[model samples]
Target: MELYFLGTNAGVPSLQRNVTSIALRLLEERRSLWLFDCGEGTQHQILKSPLKLSKLEKVFITHMHGDHVFGLPGLLSSRGAQGVTAPLAIYGPPGIKSFIETSLTISQSRVPYTMDIIEHTGGVIFEDKYFRVEAAGLDHRADSYGYRVVEKDLPGSLDPKRLEAYGLKPGPQYGKLKRGESVELGDGSWIHPADVLLAPKKGRVVTILGDTRPCPGVEVLAKDADVLVHEATFMEDLAELAHEYYHSTAKQAAEAAVRGGVKSLFLTHFSSRYKDVEHLQPLLQEAKEVFEHTRLAEDFGLYPVQRST
Candidate 1:
């Protein structure tokens, strides 16, 4: 799985960064893309990347703010013109249903595919065989949410040497054993898979926080996560502004990551006051100083989860 940061700016689009949007590319038996937070100008941002609008099977809205969801109607309308006939499911806070209904009604837009808009409260938002997404309310101006996308635990690798010791050759039966199935031989002896297989590898966890301040609920939601994508709308020195705006500062985001025991921290949602992103370097540096693995999220940057770690 990989995260494609299509937009990384806050409030409005800037020359360096657009609004907020992200695509989670999951490669399993099939290729699927999960989108989080379609901010204003999101469709325009997606055009600049390699993502297919048709492959966006699901969308999770963090809040109902204009910067976070103004692009929803436009993107959904454009999906039909781009030959996206697949049904899409949207998950968001309580106001999402009314927001989508009012927007689509005012625009007179009708989609060709089935669309399910779920007004979420809390807990697990969506779950399938490959991945499960859970959500919790965050401390923000509106009814904001934080999402945790967790892949299912993968099967343990089979030990070839141990398989040979059991007089088993590499064949169709070996594949069955790898699936935790027991097979009996003609000699009335049975071989168990648990003896030859290693423990299941825990799945990687990626947590995304909407516009929020440092809160205990966020720390609980992102506990031990592989990647914690937290919004840093201001520098460390702007703590007063952060509190006033109901947003987080770079230092606060890093503190949450450290307290949550996250392996890595990705800081995004930059303020649009600066012309060059170099101005934001010190803010990111402040985060990295606190959490050694913190990194500033750049537009079109792909953050791949390390498997061996």
Candidate 2:
């Protein structure tokens, strides 16, 4: 899977950064794309990327902030115009439904596809054969949330040569063995899959949090994640200011990632005041002091999420 950052700035847009929006490209995993937050100009950001609007299947909003959801109406309407007939699902806090409905109504936009709005209450929001999504309430100015995406373990590779050695040709029996089921041969001998198949590959976990201060349950949600995407709206010196504004500093985000035992930490949601690239050096340095694997995210940057060895 791959994460594409549409906008990485906090509160407002700047020359180098926009607001807050991220697109998780799951085309190889699920043949669809999932969006997190839809900050203003997010659709315009997507237009500059390789992502297709028709491939969008679901959107998860963190809060009702204007920077987090102002681009929803335009993206939804554009999806309809692109002839995406599949149903679209959106998960967010309570006010999300009203915001979307009112915006669509006021604009008189006609979407040809059915939209499913789920107001989650800090629990497992979605699950399927391939992946599962869990949500938790964050400590933000509004009812913000954090999402954890867990991919299910994939089956081990099957050896055709080994199967052929047992007088078994490639057929349904191979399928059964690949699924961890024992198969009976004509000689009344049972062949176990574990003896020949490779070990099952464990899935990866990704945790992304919305605008929030240092909050509880972040460690639980981000524990052992392959990557933790946290917001660092300020530097270490302005930590008190960040807390007062219900945001987090780079040091605090790094501390959470270290406590959560995540493999890598990606910091986003930068304040507009740090417009110069050099101005963000302090934030990166402070975060790296705590967690060496931490990196700052840039607008329109693509980050690949891979399973740990």
Candidate 3:
């Protein structure tokens, strides 16, 4: 899996960065794309990337802020023009449904595909054979949320050479053995899978938070995450201002990532005050002071979500 940052600025669009929008590319995992937020001008941002609007299977809104959701109507309408007939599901806090419906209604826009708007209140919002998504309320000014995307563990790889050494040739039985199934031989002896199979490979966990300050929910939602994507709306020096605005500072975001034991920390949602890379370097340095693996996100940058071996 990979994370594509379409926009990373906070509140408003800057010349260098746009508002909040992140795409989790699951082409290899599930053949779909999951959007984290649909900030203003998000559709335009997507157009500049390799992501396909037709592959957008789901959208998870963190809050009802205009900067985070103003692009929903345009995106949905454009998806219709792209001839996306597959069903789409959107999950978010309350009022998200009303916002989408009202926007589409006012514009008289019609999407060709069916859409399901789910108002979630925490816990598991979606689960399938390959993955599960859990949501938790965050400490933001509004009813913002954080999402935990957990990929399910997969069966261990089967050693075909080992099977051959055991007088068993590779065939349909090998497939069954890889699935942890027992097979009976002509001699009526059962071949157990545990004798040849390795331990199951653990899946990767990623946590992405909305606009939030320092809170207990942050730690709980991002525990042991492979990658923790948190908002750093201010520098370490302006921590008080960050708290006043119900946002997190770069230092605070690093602290949370360290506390959660995440392997990597991605600091995003930067304030427009930092106009250029030179201005944003201090924020990245501040976060790296606390967490060595911390990195600052830029618009259109793609990050790989590495799995823990």
**Steric collisions counted per model:** 0, 0, 0
TM-score each candidate.
0.95, 0.95, 0.97
Error of 1 at 162 (Å): 1.7
Q: Is candidate 2 or candidate 3 better by lDDT?
A: 3
User: Which structure is stronger by lDDT: 1 or 2?
Assistant: 2
Q: Where is model 2 poorest over a 10-residue stretch in terms of lDDT?
A: 156-165
Candidate 1, position 78, lDDT: 91
Which window of ten consecutive residues has the lowest lDDT sum in model 1?
Answer: 25-34
Q: Between prediction 1 and prediction 3, which has the larger lDDT? A: 3
Please give the CA lDDT of all the candidate structures: 0.87, 0.92, 0.93
Error of 2 at 99 (Å): 0.5
Give the per-residue lDDT of model 2 (tens digit) for 63-180.
9999999999999999898888999999999999999999999999989999999998789999999999999989998999999999999887887777677888888988898888
By lDDT, rank the candidates, best first: 3, 2, 1
Model 2 C-alpha lDDT versus the unseen true structure = 0.92
- C-alpha-based local distance difference test score of model 3: 0.93
Residue 104 of candidate 3: its Cα lDDT? 93
Candidate 1, number of clashes: 0
The alpha-carbon lDDT assigned to residue 256 of candidate 1 equals 93
